[model samples]
Target chain A: MKIVLCVKQVPDTSDIKWTENNTIQREGLESIINPYDVYAFESALRLKNKYKNVNISALTMGPKQAEGMLRKLIAIGVDDAVLLSDKKFAGADTFATAKTIAAAIKSKLSDFDLIVCGQFAIDGDTAQTGPSIANFLDIPQVTYVKEVVGYEDGYLTVIRELDSGFEKVRVKLPALICVLQGEFEPVRARINGIIHSQQVEIPVYGIDDIGLSVEDAGLKGSPTYVNKAYRAPQKETECVFVESCEELAECIKKCGGICE
Target chain B: MSKGILVYSEITSDDYLHTVVFELANKAVELSKKMEDAPVMALVLTKPDLINEYKEAFQKSGFDKVFYVVDERFGTYRTDLFAKAAVQAVKQIDPEIMLVGATCQGRDLAPRISTALGTGLTADCTGLDILENGKFAATRPTFGGQLMATILCKKYPQMASVRPKVFKPSEVDVTRDTVFIKMSVDLDDYVPQIEVLEFTKKLVCDLNDLDSAKIIVAGGKGMKNAEGFALLKKLADKLGGCVGASRVAVEMGLAPQAVQIGQTGKTVSPKLYIACGISGALQHTIGMNSAEKIIAINTDKNAPIFDICDYGIVGDAFEIIPKLLEL
Candidate 1:
């Protein structure tokens, strides 16, 4: 089995702080592999462990600093790693990003059977890249996948999450699955694995390396524009405190919040 | 005549239009009014059995026209087929703005259609405004609710999706003259890459009905584990409400996305909201700020949840929830 997992490096939004003027202070914020992408990598690693002769490679497209993330993936047992780093790839939307990623996958790992990605990145939070990659590759894709249940004979069965409930479906080989952060727990790097990854040389691919022209790679390729970004307006509500749970119940009853 | 605003009236599995479509239609009507009363249209793709019902829905919902595709194959919501039909309709009609509900199916279908049409889609928009220049300015919380980005698509037929219950459904105007146009699209070229074999609809209302809950008892990262959620559920049961969760709880698997109340999840405005073990980050608060009254129960008095709640109780949720249950 041959697999490719798409990973992204994003600012850890949890520790984020807003400036006095209501703008995010980008300085000093740590960049980590997208939390959801960690699950995608973990899923691929689990599949590799389950099957024989599985070759898994993790890839990311970002600044040169993204090599750190790929290195971490290598430490956790991804067979190989590739970094799509170039100035031309900056400010790409999901559409352009998926195009560049599809080109890389086709040119580098043509015989790949499956591609896995996080359902959405915490930074952009657009769940479109993976499916858009499938569209560009002209392959099938299933998004919001909670679990990858079974794989056999070039077909994979997955449990997909729906607003109403869950759907069990089977997709053929040469497909892409976008994983949601569900029960799949991501693993840490072992000391031996860390030592081994340090010795591996990671490959970097540029815009030309992926067979894409500058016009098709970055901001020019993007169709959307962020006109403005600002802090959300806070609603004014004067809050009071209740000392005990009994007082809380009394307050709830008073607000007509408890329906008969 | 200029192209009008289009709303996709999504049909559910049980042969009824989803309420979010009506909500979108309401906004569409309001938006179209600003654009010189340029018509508000709807696109419905379904079987012939319920075509008239859907047409009636569009008419009642105040659409000026209903562009529909009727085929037996359209009974189930298939992304490949639906997006094809939708993109074809958009090409033919060429609407100025397109709105789709940010439901599970819509989230999947919209991106495919938008990508095919080379348009940008703003997902889970909490606010949509018609700029003075007439472009649609869509506002959505981004980066785990750290900032709200107001976006505009540089391309035509500006696309955006709104979460369910973000806007109120407009009152039906049964007297309006709504034209019904039957759009034809040949589905022979479409091969479904993914097939829905079976769907298991979870019957537990509390599991999926957090948006409509009058009272929502929500937990956050501090809930720690499944047992912590179990305690919140017990308190929710006593209050005759539902259990809600912050994005962290959902991310931690303490609760499912269905019950998650946050920027990434459902935007809820319950009558009374109880925050149990929730630290009250902006991401979680963005979804529940509209609640009529908020109660915070956390051991840390400085937890941000206390700042926004109307009633703050400084104590462990495990300890306080049991006391509340007894009360």
Candidate 2:
């Protein structure tokens, strides 16, 4: 079984700072593989360990800097890595992003039996890219997947987390599954694995490599755009302190106006 | 000329609309009033029989028109099926704005629908308003709740998903009336390739339902370790309240994610919110800020939690919690 995992490099939200103009300041802040995508990579490695013929590949789309994220994936135990990087791909929304990924997948259609992704990228939190790519590819896609059951010849069974409960879903092979964060423990990076990853060369594909035109893969393809962003004015409220339990009780009673 | 607002009515298994749906309906009514009798549209995607169960409720909740998409395949919540039906409905109605509850289903469905319709979506919004030109202005916390950003959608029918309990539901008027419109959708048109075999509800601790609890005891990073949360649990039991944690607590593996109350966590509104050793980051305050009264018990008097707290005590929660429990 061959599996392809899509990973994204997002600014480490922990160290994120804002510009005076309200735009995210990514300069100097480190970027890491999206925390959720780590779960996807781990899940793929787990499957590889379970099946002898299993092969895993990591796929990502962003600037050339994103290739570094793929190296981390290979170090954790992926067979290969592919980066679809192009300057024209900048400012692509979830739709265009999914289209670009779909194009890459189509370019390598015969190499994989399944595609996996993090449930959502923390930066965007849209959670739409995976399903949109699935829609674009016209394949079955499941989001918020927490557990994966055994796979049959042509079908895969998995459990999805819902608002109220969990649902068991079965989809045919060559489908997409987006794993949620903390769904599985991530694999530890081994020194030998890191050494091997340093030797593994990542294949970078551009718009032409994926057989997609610039008009169809980047900002031009994105329909949504941010018009303006401004800081919201804070609402004013008065705070009262109570030093003792009796004072607290009295304050509560006064606030309620003694119940008429 | 008036505008129409579409609300994706989130439904529970017990057949009642979720709290957030009603809140959005109430907000829609407020927005509609401002827009000169703009119709508040309720979009219900459910089984045909389930439509009747919600008709009166929608009417009372101030929906001017209820669009019901009755299909057997939509009996369950599937992202693709629901989003496709909703996008089609929006296209047919051409509402000026759409609102959905920021629950798991709404978070999943709204983004997809926005993508399908090629529109912008603001998620996890805390507030909504209409601009002079009738554009939807959605406000949500950004920069991890350090700042709030109000976004405007240049596209028509601006979409937003408001957090649950962010807006209060209005009093239901049983005598209120509405126009019902039925939409026919072909289930086979967009078949869900994935089949749901069964649903298993995780047994989350019932003691963590902080929103409805009269009293809530919450801990933060200052709680030290997992054992600190155990102490919070004991205090919660004594107070007959539920236990909640900040995002830090959940990230530290001190508590389950469900019980976490913060910007990225559950938004809880309780009568009394007791902060134990909580420094009160902005992200944490967004969840419990709506509480009727807040009491902060932290050793650091400079903790941001003290700024918004109704009562602040400059003492150790570990030492004070035990004394309070004995009292």
Candidate 3:
């Protein structure tokens, strides 16, 4: 079975800082694999460890620096890696990003059975790219997946997380699943895996290499554009400070806290 | 060009109209006014028996018209099935603007619909409005709530999935003759791509249900232990609300990860959010700052929580909460 893991490199949102003028200052922030994508990779690796002849390929679309992150995935457990690197792919919204990714998969990894992606990226946090990719490929997609319960006979059972609860569904291959971040322990890269990564050839695909025109690869392909960007307003509350809990409880009551 | 404003009225697993539908309806009314009173409409896909449940909501919420498609397979949500039906509805109606609630299910469905239509969709929008040129503008938080961007879509169906509760529902029911139109779509040739085997609803009144809670009492690393959380839980119970946690508190196991409220977790807009022992980082505060009222209790007088709270107490949550719970 062949699985493609769609991963992204994002700024570590936790380490992002703010300037004195209330603007985001990301100059010194480090870029790392999106935290949710790690969970997705873990899910894929679990299948490989449990089953036989399961190969996982890591794919990403970003600047050439993204090749480093893909190599890291190789050391962890990925069978191979593909970097869809091109200046034309930068700044594309989910629409264009999905087009570029689906194009690469069709042109390069066309025979793949499944694609797994993190439910969201910390930088975009759109949670749209995964499903959009599935749409562009004309395949089924399941989002907010918590677990891959079981897989047999070309079918995989997944537990999807909902706003209210969880639903387990059995979906066939040629599908895409976006997984939520779950509580997972770190998976260390084996020494042998590290040695192999050093010798492995990471293939790079450009806009033309993926059968995409420059117009269909980047901002030109994107339908949405940022009109204005600013700091979110901090609504002034004129917060009244109180010394005692009695006043706090009184205020809570006035705010309609208690209800039948 | 598109003519009307359309909202995807989602029916949840509980077999009821998701509250976000009414919330979107309320916002849609305003946007319609801005669009020279463009008609406000709704689209629903559900089983035949469950079809009528949303009518009163549509009427009272001031929806001008409703278009629905029913099939037995709609008993539960299947992305393949729903998206197919919704895409058909969009083609049939050809609305100028489409709004979807950014709940887990809506987020799962919106992109597929937008991509199928070859249009743009702005995700998790906190604000929606019309520009001077009449293009739809969606304002949303980007880079994990660190920066806000006003986005514009240059395609048809100016689609956006709005964050729930950002716009409040109407206070009074509006009496409108909402026209109901039943649209026909044949799925006999359609085959199910996925089979739902089991479902487990989260426990009712779960402390993690911050989205619908009227009030929430959340804690942070200052909530040092189970004992601190126990105090928070007590206050939450006293207020008939729920308990939420900062990512640090969840990491420390003071609260379950399900209840973690931050940039990476659930965004809530409860009526009152009592932030105890929390120093409001932008990541944490952005999730709850939309609450109508917020009160914070911490030992540090200059905690950032005070910057966004409606009330502040520069003292211990331990001492303050116990007394508040006693009331």
Candidate 4:
């Protein structure tokens, strides 16, 4: 079985600071693997353990520096790593990003049996990249997948968490699944694994290497454009500060009035 | 010319029209009015008889036309089939803007349709509007909800998905002479890729269902223990609402994951959200900010929750929540 797990490096948004221009201060920002992707990697490792001849590759699209993140994936037990990076890929919306990734998968990891992606990325939070990539690859996709239950007879059984409940589904091979964060501690990379990762070469694919035109790989390829970014308007209620619980009750009665 | 704003109507697992349909319909009416009162429309794909069950809702929600494709395959939502039908519907209607409620199904289905149509889709938008030049504008939180960006789609039939509760439905219905158009879809060579084994409803549905709750009383790290959450539950019960918890509170075992609200948790925009003992991290605030009214009670006046809340009370939840219950 061959699996390609898509991963992303996201800044720790909790520790993020904003620039005066309302953009994120990316310099000196601490970046880590997307939490959900960590779960996806864990899922792949579990499958590797369950079945013989199971190979896993970690794929990501970002800046060239993301190779460092890819090496970390290799260190954490991914048999191979692929980085799709280029300045031409900057400011790409979900469409363009998925386009780049689907192209990379076709050119680099052709005949892959499965694609796994984190349900959402912290920076973008779009949750569209995985499904769009599936569409670009012309494969079926299942989103909000909680975990892979097992594999049998070329079909993979998985659980999908919906708003109201959970659905257990069995998808055929060559499908994509977007994984949700699960309750498991991620495995740490051992010393020998880290050393081997440093010694191995990880190929980086730019837009040209992937046979994509410059105009069709990034912002130019994206149909959506950010018109403006600003702080969400703060609610201006004058925040009548009440000192005691009794005063709070009185305030709600007068204004909040919804309380009986 | 692309002349209408189309919204998707979903029949939920509970076998009823998801309330978010009406919410999006009302918002579409507002956006359409700004676009020279362009027609507001909807698309529903459900079991054959389900369209009749939802006709009154479409009529009362101010839709000028409701295009529906009834098929047995729609009994269970398979992305390929739904997207195929939706793509065909959009190609025929040629609406200028397409809006879908950012529910679990909508989030999963909208992007597929957009990708198939080769158009831009802004996901989980908190704001939607029309620019002066008649382009669709969508605003959503990016970077873990730390910043907000308003976007525009250059392609035709611009698309976006807004979460439930972000917009309130109009109190008064604008009943329209709705045209129910029964459309047909060609599903040739489209096969189901996944087989359904079972669907198990989580027994804790009531607590997790914050989507339709009109009011929510939430606690945070300041709500020290289960006892603190018990008080919140009492207040929630008194107010005829549900109880919610911040991530820290959930981690502390003060509440279950089912009731957690934050960037990672469910996005809730109830009529009234009473945040008790929450310090208002950007993560927690982003989920609840859409509430029509917010009242924050915390010991520290400097807690950021007070900044975005409609009212601030510098008191302990242990003391204040009980008083609110007394009222």
Candidate 5:
């Protein structure tokens, strides 16, 4: 089985800080492989363990600095890594990002059986990239996937988390699954693995290498534009609470006014 | 010439329309009223048998016209088939604005349809307004909900997928003369790639539907363990409300994903919200900040949750929760 997992390197959102201009301060914040993408990598590794002759390639689209993230994936046990980085691919939205990735998958690693991605990147929070990539690749996709049960005859059974309940879906081979952080625990990199990763040559794909026009690959191709970004105003209040539950219940009636 | 605003009537399999459909419809009606009272149309996709079952309800949904695709294959929610039908409808109607409920299915379908139509789509929007030029100004929380970004689409049929409960649904009336246009879609050409095997409902302790709950008792990472949420559930039961949790608690396995309130989870606006052990990150606060009243219980005095709450108690939830339960 051949698989390609799309990964992203994002600033650790929990430790993020904003500047006076409302721009993210990306300097001090440590950039790691998007936390959600690790679960996708883990899923592919599990499949590699289950099947014979399985190859997993981790791919990411970002700046030249993102090669460090690809190496991290290789260290964590990906068979190979590719960094789709170029100045032309900068400021791409989900649609343009998906377009570039689809082109990379076609040109670099064709005939892959599956594509796995994290449910959503914590930075963008769009959750649209995986589905858009699946659409660009003309493959079926299931998001919010909680579990990858197993592979059977020409189909993969997976559990999807929905709003009301869980649905067990069986998508044919050559499909994509957007994984969620569930039962799978991410594996750590070993000493030898880290050494081998640094030694592996990561190929960088530019827009010309991927056969994309300059106008179609980046900000120019994005249809939606961010007009403005502003801090959410803080709510004002004079908050009070009680020591005991009985007193708390009374406070709810007295202070809250609705807790009769 | 710019056409009127359009809505996708989101109906569940149980022959019920989702509350979000009406919420968007009401919002669309208001938007249209601002745009010289341009028609607010609804595109309803359902089985033939289910059309009459929901026709009058759709008529009262404040839409001036309803474009319905009634085919047997349309009975189930499949991305490829629905997107194709919807794209065809959008081409025929040429709506200036399209509103879809940001449910699981809508999130999947809207992007596919918008991409197919070569248009822009704003996802998971919390606010929608008409700009001076009549373009739909979609406002959504970005950067983990620390800031709100208002986006504008360069292409036509400016589309947005709005979260449920962002706006309240209007009351339904029986006498409204909402026009229904029956449409046909051929599904033979589009083959669905994914097959549904089985659907199982998860059994949790609370039957509370967080979307409409009047009172919500929510916990956070400070809840420590699953046992902490059990205490929240008890307090919620006493208040005749539901138990909600921050994304951290859901990620910590202290609560189910269904109960999580955050940028990635459900956006709720209850009458009274009692937050316990919640440090109130922007991601979690964005979902519940619309509540009419808020009360926070956290041991840390400087917890951000206190800044947003109407009333707050600086105490350990574990100690105070037990006392609140005695009543």
Candidate 6:
């Protein structure tokens, strides 16, 4: 069985600082593999470790700089890595994103049986890509997944997380599953694995390579656009001081606030 | 002619409408009154037998029209199928505005319907109002919960997904009545690519259910470590309350995500909310601002949490919590 894990290289949101021009200062801030995608990568690695016949492949779309993330995934135990890098793929939203990814998967149609991705990208938090990709592929999608029960001949049992609770779901082979963050802890990198990944060659695919027109890959294909981005005004509130134990008790009593 | 506002009524596991459904109903009525005697319409996907159980609740909550799709396949939420049915219904009924709760199901269904109808959708709105020209002005937090922005859709049947607990539900009117409209759809034509095989509930800690708790004791980054959280638990247990946390506390791994109270987390409205060692960022305060009474305990007297708090303690939470636990 061959598993394809969709990963992304995103700006570390925690470290993002704004410049005077209201744009993100990507300078000095390091880029890493999206945290949620790590869970998907770990899940794929676990499957490979359990089954000797299983092979895991890493796939991502971003600038050429994203090749570093793919290399890191290869270091962590993936067998092959592919980068969908091109200026035409810039500014694509979830819909266009799913299209490009589906096209990439189709190019390797013979060997792939399952596809996995993180539940959502932290930067967007839209949680639309996985389902949209499933729709494009015309396959069943299980989202907010916590664990995989087991895989049979052509069906896989899995557990999905709902707002109130969870339910057991089963989807056939050739399906998409989005794993939630912290679903499973990642494996520690070994010395041999790191050396092997450094020596491995990663293939890059552009617009023509994927058989997609430049118009269908990027800003032109995206339906939703961020018209403008600005910071929200902050609301002001007054702070009060409570000095002594007596003052604290009096404040609690006068305010009728929480206390035993 | 007065225009009617529609709400997509979502169902809970207990076979009742989710609380947000009635909240939206109350909001719809408010919006409808602005349109000269318009009525609020509720669209439910359920069986005929189930409709009877929810009809009175809808009427009591201010629904003037109860439009329903009664079918077995409608029991579970399927986005494409529901969107197809809802789009068809809206085209026939012709509502001026549509409101949906920003729950997981709503987040999935609203966009699909909006896209299919070629309308605009404003998601996770914190505020809503009718402009002078009678357009829906929706306000929502953006940029990782740092700012609030108001937006207007250029298209008709303006749709918005309201965050739950942002609005209050109206008092039930037992004397009220409603008009029930039963609608049917062919489920065989729509096939869902995603199938729900099974669901497993995560194990929630005993201290996590703070929303329903009468007393809620929450700690923040100021609590410092696990020992501080343990102290908070003792106080919560003594006060017969549950423990809650700020986003900082959750990020620090001192508490679980379920107990997080903030803009991105659960919005809680308990009777009494105790903030221990919390500085009270605006995002956290928005979630707990509706609580009946608030008591803030932090070492920094100038911490922002004191402003919204009904009571303030400028002492260390490490000292206050332990003393309170003994009492």
In order, what lDDT does every prediction score? 0.84, 0.77, 0.87, 0.85, 0.83, 0.74
Model 5 lDDT per residue over B223-321, tens place: 899789899887887788899999888888888777889888889998889999999888888899999888889999899888888777788889888
- What tens digits encode model 1's per-residue C-alpha lDDT throughout A91-138? 887778888999999999889999999987877776778878887887
Q: In model 2, state the lDDT of residue B85.
A: 80
What are the per-residue Cα lDDT tens digits for candidate 6 across B272-297? 78899998876687678778778889
Worst 10 residues of 2 chain B by lDDT: B202-211
Residue-by-residue lDDT tens digits, candidate 1, B196-283:
8788887875464886788888999888998999988887777788899988888788988778787667788888888988998887
Give every collision pair in model 2: none
**Docking quality level of the chain pair in candidate 2:** acceptable
Q: List the residue pairs that clash in candidate 3.
A: none
Error of 6 at B81 (Å): 6.8
Candidates' chain B TM-scores in the order shown: 0.95, 0.94, 0.92, 0.87, 0.95, 0.89
DockQ of each: 0.67, 0.35, 0.67, 0.61, 0.61, 0.26
Comparing 2 with 3 on DockQ, the higher-scoring candidate is: 3
Q: How do the residues A6-124 of candidate 4 rate in per-residue lDDT, one tens digit apiece?
A: 99988988788778876678898998988779878888888998999998998998888888988888887888888888999999999999999999999999889989998888778
**Best candidate, lDDT:** 3
DockQ of 4: 0.61
- Kindly list the per-residue Cα lDDT of model 2 for residues A1-260, writing each as its tens digit: 98989999877665667788866676897888887788788777778887778889889998898877788777878878889899888878677888899999998655578999998675665566887787677666777777777688778898776656778988877888988655466477899779978999888888898888887767777755554555434434445655664454354344331211
CAPRI level of candidate 3: medium
Better of 3 and 4 by TM-score: 3
lDDT of 2 by residue, B1-327 (tens): 127899988776556778787889889888887788788888888877778877777878888888888877667777667877887877888888899887877876776677667666777888788778766788777655655667776566788888787899897563357999998755567856667788877565654665567778899988989778888888787767889998777767787766778766678888878888888776678788888888778888777787787776777777766666555
Candidate 2 residue A59 Cα shift, in angstroms, is: 2.4
**RMSD (CA, Å), each prediction:** 1.9, 3.7, 2.4, 2.8, 2.1, 4.4
Which CAPRI level is candidate 1? medium
